[model samples]
Target: MYTEHPGSCSTTGAIGLERTRFFPRQLITPDDLIQDQIYFRDKLRRHNRLLHGWGVVCGARIKPGTGECEIVIEPGYILGPYGDEIYIDQEVTVNLCQQGTDGNAISPCSDMTDPWCSNIRVDRQSNKPYYLAVRYAECQTRPVRVVGTSCGCNEIECEYSRIRDSYAIKLLSELPSTYADPMPQPNLDDVARCTPDHACPACPTEPWVILADITLGAGSKVTKEGIDCFAHRRHVVSFANYYYLCKSTTLPVVRSIFPGNGINLNNDQALLREWAQRPLLKITFDREMAMPKLSEPDAWLRFWQLRSDDNLTVVRRIFLALSPENPPATDESGFTATYQLRAGAQELFQSRFLIQIRATADTITDTTTPPNLLDADFSGTKLSSEQLNQVWNVTDQTTLSIEILNNLSTTDATLPSGDRAAGGQFHSWFAVLG
Candidate 1:
């Protein structure tokens, strides 16, 4: 019904009479409906009623594939106050309601539900256009008498004169009581206050208020009274790597409660003794406060003086080594020697490694060449970042087999006096006595 125009021509019988029809005679009739026999006219009336309520009417557009079909029912009406002689450029508010099966618009008139509009579907298919059906009571009431004129005349001029000249068929001099009152806005202050600090509208006491200086290894100070302050959160205490939240008063209490909360030894010797065998070391301090505050960069620098530790402990020279076979220290005579060098354990944070190969000379007879000082030859061999950890242990008891060659230009090495051993460099293979 929406697709076909009224003035499309059709051909007929052998006489060949071609005539124009205002509407397609092949429209879907109520008889074609599955259930109701009289649903078509009712649906059309509902469509017209909704259109009028919204200041709109249905307009048909010809489909491209075939001239007989209509694409959609377009809105053809405009909104303006009577006698205003105005040009409207904006959409008018619509009054919407749910559509019943009988094609009538229904509104909420009961106490159970409040006034609200729903989308009215003209057809069940997903692709079809639907109307937002607003109820009559929901729309604003205005007193104006208007008459529609013929379609062929200038619509704008005809509509203007009809609205300006017509008499009112219905009359109500006074405005409705409900219409005069201003709409009330909902209170939002309570809602704003109800939100948790971490949620929307964050409260001042929210936990985890991101602090710039609370990075790893940072610690705070506490005063005798209760002033808990932090130094520059910028300090990267090798022990930890996160930011610190400090309190002046609680720190002293925590220190007293847990004496070993941080490094305690006042002497380097004692510290060394305790940490000699330890592989990795970490130190953390208690800086919990009753109420923690944000520690911005400027704020931390401003409070640096108050939290500075005057007698700060320093980490002296520390040696680290990992050798599965660390040989004993020796003299030039290849003599077995005793070593006191501390074999330090690898720390957790270290990425590289250190290896030492100590050899003791026992048999040094000082003969001819005296086994050229075993020089570790580091020549061509693919070595990468991962292979840097490799270590070779060469002790006094280790043996080496050397083979020197002289190139004779020919393949035969033992041919004759003129064909001396093929000349080439000597190859030495080092191995343990075992």
Candidate 2:
């Protein structure tokens, strides 16, 4: 029954439940859970190994035009019972060229046109090292080995690609230890828990493990589905309703020109000046209620403003209008035409300083543009530049009455007929603006 701010009634604020409730799902589906488990288990192993003390870690950069963001290893790192092979187990690294505005690589990695395509080798037939492109199945997460045969007395039959003329091996200082004696492959699960610092007791030494760090840019776009997912998770603990103990919190202090709630305009300019510098306006509503919906036509706002000096008193009122049936050609500004400043005195203005048009509802068949807002109270008073200066000289204290008139074409539209039901799209606020 308690409410925080009287304005908490805004549409965006009214989302919590008043009580707890539960629902049952129709059937059970465990396929997704199983897949998630498998992916988590395998992915852990694929990135967890640190084999030959010299294996290379490959990943992509994802920074801005000059920054890197993605760093995924291809087939990750390799582990073998036999000592590393000279060139057979050699690890090659390449960068994936980002597509440019025209869809071509600005700086193509010619040596590895497509890591997604085939394995490229370094050609050392000449004094300088160069890479030669070869054909192979599209490279995925698995590494593919190529073999070639040598034909001569001096050359034993070699099973590998000679694209590099076998000269690239010279670039590597220490050769892969011989693995003629083999040990049983470790269980993939246990291997996942094994750290790179210690691949095995028998394996020569741990391989070089490369780790990449990246930061995402602020321009990243997020979809509504993503927000909904977060909300769904939060809802687990914030089940509908089941209200918590309500306590009043001190509201921000704000200065009010029209003093008191019932009927008092201590319209003293000196008093008003002191109130204005209080930083914030504090109002105690007594209790906390769910946040309110501002869009509700019956919803209205009221506040008072006093000059910084001890000389003026101004009261402000606000209202909302609906574009029912056929909307107006142009939206009306302000909420009412006639503002009853005092009982029996009604001033009609084409505009009200307080009324504002926000949005319009779609019409069934009317092609005319709808009136988004209709402000009326400010219509008549030509308080032009000079008239507004005509402050109500309060020689004697007087009670001021205010009534706002809503004259939009839709003011008479049909509304539900009960107090509990929504009233017509009309509301009123009154204050003694001294």
TM-score winner among the candidates?
Answer: 2
Task: Pick the lDDT winner.
Answer: 2
Candidate 1: segments with Cα more than 4 A from true spot: 1-180, 183-185, 190-434
lDDT per residue as tens, model 2, 173-237 = 12223211121343658755756675344423322111221222233221122111111010111
Model 2: lDDT equals: 0.23
Residue 320 displacement (Å), model 2: 0.7
Q: Candidate 1, residues 166-197: lDDT per residue as tens digits?
A: 11000112222222123243355764566555
Instruction: Give the C-alpha miss distance for residue 357 in model 2, angstroms.
Output: 9.1
Give the alpha-carbon lDDT of every model. Answer: 0.20, 0.23
For model 2 the TM-score comes to 0.17
